[model samples]
Target: MFAGSNRLTIDDKGRLAIPARLRAQLADEYGKELAVTLGPECIEIYPAPVFRTMAQQIPKIADRAKRVLVQRLFLGNAVESEIDGQGRIGVPPLLRDMKALGTDVVLVGAYDHFELWSYAQWQANNTEGQTHYADAFAALAVP
Candidate 1:
């Protein structure tokens, strides 16, 4: 049920604090365990339980090659992590470097998980739907 966005920062030590509004939901429902990995255009964070469920799907992909590729890209790069008492989570150096995310950031609540995007990257990809809205809504069959 996670939904919405927050502007945040990764401190020099590379920790980002979850907003207080979402902190309790995460702590109470998900516990401290977490998994982080690089996603298509941003870094992804998932509760350990949720991540485990996704990991299990890797072996079920019908295509052998695609399954293997996904395993390596998703599972291979995942880093186990947790939220600290101060409510901050450590962003793995690898994922941070890969996503160029050492500064201001955008934390987007994706139904079951969260996405961390570099501020610049977010701005670049979040252009107003001036050009793509029609195709996008059409694809989703929205009226």
Candidate 2:
């Protein structure tokens, strides 16, 4: 039930700390292991078990082309990491390059995972979402 946004900085070592409030829940549910990967527009952090479930779902895809696409988008770039005692997870250079992560990043809660977006990208993304909110909400049947 992660539901908030957190603004954080990437340390010199490229580590981003998970917000304290969410640390305990993550520790309890997934221990120190996490699976990180590139999303369409951001880096996504997932509990190892949660990521395993997601990986399992990929293979069930019936469309060969779509399945391959999912595999390449997810499996190909996925990296397994461990959260340290201070609650920090290291973002690999490749992942950083792929997502264009700058020093400042925004961690947006996304139910099953947290999305990491550069500050500028997050701002732009929010602006886009704001413009489409009415139509998006209507599509979701929100009244």
Candidate 3:
């Protein structure tokens, strides 16, 4: 499971190095390939197998609605990438633009997946979301 946060920089070529610990986990499960996709407010990185499972779950619907939703979310922007020998993956142009990724980014481990966020955007998101965190945990408490 991926867990913890790391601050990383995108190189001039727009490549970010996966943290060594995370890289080990990915290597064990996926060899070196990963799937990058647009997430709610950031970019999601998935080990190939996990990505495949997710892809398979996209419901099959009528041609009209299915094409719009599935194509936009699954086919429209997903990029398949391979981790380089040095353990870095290049963020594609479209994904970077979608997330407004700059030089500094926050890599957040999200259990089975990871998310990449621009440093500034992450700060804003965390600040806004922190207040509700206590409520979320409290709701889960055993009555």
Candidate 4:
């Protein structure tokens, strides 16, 4: 039940300290292992077990294009990491480079995983989301 958003800073070495509340939950239930990969517009992080479960659920495909896409884009991009004693998880260089992440970032809890967004990127995404808010809500049938 990861939820809410928090502003954070990436250390010079590209490690981010997970917030205490979420950190405690993860430590108790999942230990320190994590999987990181690039998302559509941000970096995604999932507990290692959670990631494994999700990976297993990815439907098998006979279509060559779909299979290739999944393998190359999702599985190939994933990197395993461990949260350090200080609650910090190091972002993979490839993942960080893809997202153009800098020191200032925001951690957004996206239901099943977390999205790491550079501050500027998050702001731009939020602004664009506003333009589609009506359509998005309508699609969800939310009143």
Candidate 5:
């Protein structure tokens, strides 16, 4: 049900505060534990239960090579983190390095998780993706 985008900053210590609106939901569902990992083009943050469910189901991917690659890169690099008392979670150096996360970021709500994108990369690609929205909508049978 998460359905919004939030522009945020990475503090000098490499942390981003979870937006206030989502804080209580996250707190009730996960307390302070979160799983952070790589997504196709962004870093993803998920509640512990949600991440565990997805990780468990990853073996269902039929292609062995693709599954292993995803397992290695996504799950292997995944880190379990605690939201500090201040509501911030620090993105690890390795995860930040793997993606182009600058100080500026866009945290997008993605139902079970949040996808964090580099502001520069997001700004550069967002407009270009608009042209394909119609195709995407059609593919989803949204018309």
Candidate 6:
């Protein structure tokens, strides 16, 4: 169970050292291979099997418009990465720029996958999401 959030720093070369607790979870579930992909507001890191399963679920369609949408959303931006001996994974330049990530970042565990966010960006996003979903969330929690 990956839980809590950790503030992380990206080295000049874009390598992020996974938190020790998260590393233990990855090691147990994924061995050493993981996949990193762009998310709506951040980046998602997943165990290889989980990533592959998600990729496979992208709908197959012969129509050009649907194909383009799926391709751009799922295939165009995906990146595969592996955790090194020191439990660090490098973020690609494009992804870093997309999320406005700098030396400081926050890694948030999302059950099956993890999300990487710039500290400021995460704060803004979290606030917006909470406000946007507050009503729905409260209803879901009814006893």
Q: Give per-residue CA lDDT, model 6, range 54-121, as digits (tens).
A: 77767657687877776685567777878888889988888888878998899998888889999998
**Which candidate achieves the best TM-score against the true structure?**
2
* Model 5 TM-score, 2 decimals: 0.91
Q: Sort the candidates on TM-score, descending order.
A: 2, 5, 4, 1, 3, 6
Model 6 weakest 10-residue run by lDDT: 66-75
**What's the TM-score of every candidate structure?**
0.89, 0.93, 0.89, 0.90, 0.91, 0.86
* Consecutive 10-residue window with the lowest summed lDDT within model 2: 134-143
lDDT of 6 at 134: 69
- lDDT string, candidate 4, 12-130, tens digits: 88899999999998888888899988777799999999999877755667787887777787788998889888999999878888899988999999987899999999999999899
Model 3 scores worst on lDDT over the 10 consecutive residues at 58-67
lDDT of 2: 0.89
- How far out, in Å, is residue 143 in model 6? 4.8
Where model 5 places Cα greater than 4 Å from the true spot, the runs are 139-143
TM-score of candidate 3 against the unseen true structure: 0.89
Clashes of each: 0, 0, 0, 0, 0, 0
C-alpha RMSD values across all candidates: 2.0, 1.5, 2.2, 1.8, 1.6, 2.2
Best lDDT goes to which candidate?
A: 2
Write the residue-wise lDDT of candidate 5 on 23-117 in tens digits.
Answer: 88898777779999998888999988888988998899999999999899889989999888898998988888889797899998898899999
Candidate 2 ranges beyond 4 A from true positions: 139-143
Sequence-dependent TM-score of model 1: 0.89
Per-residue lDDT of candidate 3, residues 1-143 (tens digit): 88999999999898999988889888886778899888767899888889888877675555768657776876567888899989899888888987899889999999898999999999999999999999988888587
Q: For model 2, how does the per-residue alpha-carbon lDDT over 66-113 read when each residue is reduced to its tens digit?
A: 999989989889999898988999998899988889799999889978
Question: Which residue pairs clash in candidate 6?
Answer: none
Evaluate model 1: give its lDDT: 0.88
> Candidate 4's error at 115, in angstroms?
0.5
